[model samples]
Target: MAKWDNMLSMLWMLRSGRKLTAAQIADSLEISVRTVYRYIDALCASGVPVVAESGHDGGIRILESFKETPLFFNSVELKALVDAFKFARGACYPYTEELESALKKVENGLHEEQRHDLSHQTSGMDVISPSRPPSVVPLLRELEQSAKEGRTVRIAYRKANVEQADEREVDPYGLAFDRNEWYAVAFCHQSQTLRTFRVDRISRLEPTEARFEKPERFSTSAYFRNQSEREREADGPLAVIRIEGEPDTLNALCGHWHLRHYLTERTDREARFLIDVPTMNKYLPMYLMTFGTAIRIREPLELKRRIQEMAYGIAKHYENDPD
Candidate 1:
């Protein structure tokens, strides 16, 4: 609440690899640019390596060594900060504790009013923890342990689509949960390839002493965005499809595959969209099948043909297998 604390906080934030202009800082702190300039002066005088650059892209930069430097935020500020980390934790189970610890420090620093405000704000935006069963928790715990230890483990898994099951030996790297499905990202010892294993579908897990190492450049975000149970893609470039349909029809396919939610949606009787698709592009074909009468594909003749073929095949199957 004090000017000195706010200045320290602002400097720490700027050091967190973010650049804030005087106007932006003033607006955020409900202060004037004149005060921000004073704070910047103090930081410079205090041996804080604050660099301000004048360009369209540059504003300020605190060199890398700034992490070892000092910054302060009271407990209330810290708990308030946990909001983003907790919001993002669904994809980064591996980083939630580090996020929580950072939040704890801020929480410990907050005064009573600040703490009350934070508690109210956090409660206002409640996120119910996913309904992970107790039995599964232990398995998840084991998977997490093995992942961190780079330990090989055997998992008995079932593929939902195939309605079949098998056992796999894998070198676990990390665990992630999306919606209701939990997945383990790991290297399959038998397949000698990286693959994702669904947690619930895992019938069994056996931790082994066989240890391994994660690849030096493994990125969980990249793996999550790229890997999912989807229609097999025919490789090349992202399949581009021109789709014309009502907004409702198109919205369902917005986030699918290489399909980007383009800014090109337009409506007459129908909305027109330019969608990028994965190589296989199942959504495009199946979608065309779903709205056989309502939607049309205006480009990519191969997709149009596939839609036609699918309809014909479905018609024939229904007629032949009238049971």
Candidate 2:
């Protein structure tokens, strides 16, 4: 029997309200008497209230109070546990098999009515991800382990738009997930700098005997956010973009993931953003065009001209076609 199984059997035997000697428990569980003593010590440490007496009446017995105390989770706690697991599973948590086994044990401990209640509570609740996530479970598990153990690993990483994957060794500091992608924040040996890698882009990963000490208090999410801020700053001088529209429309535009960060001011009928020239030329025209006449660009005549060009191109593309 497993260590926990033997210990649980000891607990049940001691719970019988009869004083049982160490020899008796050891004999019943087919373990050494010293092992029984160790199990008793462990149970006591876990607040089981096991009483061990010495002398002619020396034996072990669980406290009567503990024997009567019911071990079960309340309805609210059970529902929370199940719902939390659902969210974790949806996020592609690395320890899914262990999580499933733990949830099964929890459910098995419930009474039939409690089980029915749990099923009913969980039936109406679920975590719906945006799309089916990638199969990076194995990569995640390996990176997580390496990060925790302060180990370095070699990987064949392919950057975006790159054809061939490049081989590099890195000391994985941590991992983060954002925008439906997994990223590893590690110290790249080749670059000799801390960098983030898209986990799915990793074509191959192998453990290395080399080890490294991760910086103290390093946070993957914080690093990623900092990198984004740095990238935005590196985009050169930003142009102040002003727009006027319905209050609701301006609000929605300002709330855009990219624009929100650059937003400098807002009013009932107007919003201002600090946008770079390249971004203004590349993405804003097409995106803002979706708003149609509800909004108007109040500044930066260059952007207005780009929008006009795009609109004219669109009209020209279908000019000779039937409506």
Candidate 3:
């Protein structure tokens, strides 16, 4: 038998709660007495709780408490682990291959009936991503490693609306995923400020010898949230967006990601949000138009006028077209 197999067999023998001598174990396994002692030492190092007492009436035996405890996961635990793996894979987790290998070993330790139960439970449920996820595992792995090691990296990043990628050296603090996109929160040496870069927009990344000390209690999520809040506040002066509509329509409008942050009040037929005037005039008009007659803008006559102008423009454009 292979070394591992022999050691496992010896463990099972000790688990029988019998006080068998080293010579007796070797004789049963067709190995030398010294080999039995070596296997016992290996099992102890692996946390098997094997007890080898010397002298008469003293023999190898597993601890009573250790023998009573279950070594393999139950059905519920197995199902949760497999389902979590599915979600992680859907999110493009960088360590998915290693996670899968670890899960397989866990499953292999289960009984046949437990495995069957897990298969049946997981087959009926799955996570459905809203869109096809981007393939960014390599980028995620590299950034994660650099952040963990406190190392700086140079990246060729293409920002939105820019035609060419620019090279920048940044100290990657951490990575975050929001709204189906991956972002690296880092400190840019060129800009001398902390910034967020879209991982998918990075055209090239290379490690540098530069290193940095991460701040104590630094939280990537909190920093990202604060940045978003500051941006919203910087748009312009706050203005009330009052709308009267069907209950469901109002609910949907109030629940919008951008609008929800500013939602002030809601009723069966009305929803009120406190957002910036520039944002309302520049972006909200077209989106509100989608609701058509189902909703009515109750305040900020400027928004209603903007929506009318957009509708008239659409009407005239289509009227003049031949097709």
RMSD of each: 10.4, 12.8, 11.8
lDDT tens digits by residue: candidate 1, 1-323: 68777787777778768887878888888889898888787677556788878989877667767655545454545555766776656433545677788767766655567668677767756454655444565677788888778889988888878677788899888876654567888898778888888887787889887889888878765687565324335444554456777677766555443443332555543444443456436566775576767678776788888888888888888896756
In the range 1-89, model 2's lDDT, one tens digit per residue, is 87766877788888788999989988999999999989887677556898989999888998878844324466878899999898888
Q: Which of 1 and 3 is the better model by TM-score?
A: 3
In order of TM-score, best first, we have 3, 2, 1
- What value does the lDDT take at residue 54 in candidate 3? 90
Positional deviation of 96 in candidate 1, in angstroms? 5.8
Model 2 regions lying over 4 Å from their true place: 1-77, 127-135, 233-323
* Residue 79 shift from truth in candidate 1, angstroms: 7.4
TM-score of 2: 0.57
List lDDT for all candidates, in order: 0.69, 0.85, 0.84
| Candidate number that wins on TM-score, 2 or 3 | 3
For lDDT, the strongest prediction is 2
> For residue 6, what is the lDDT in candidate 2?
80
Clashing pairs in 2: none
Per-candidate TM equals 0.53, 0.57, 0.59
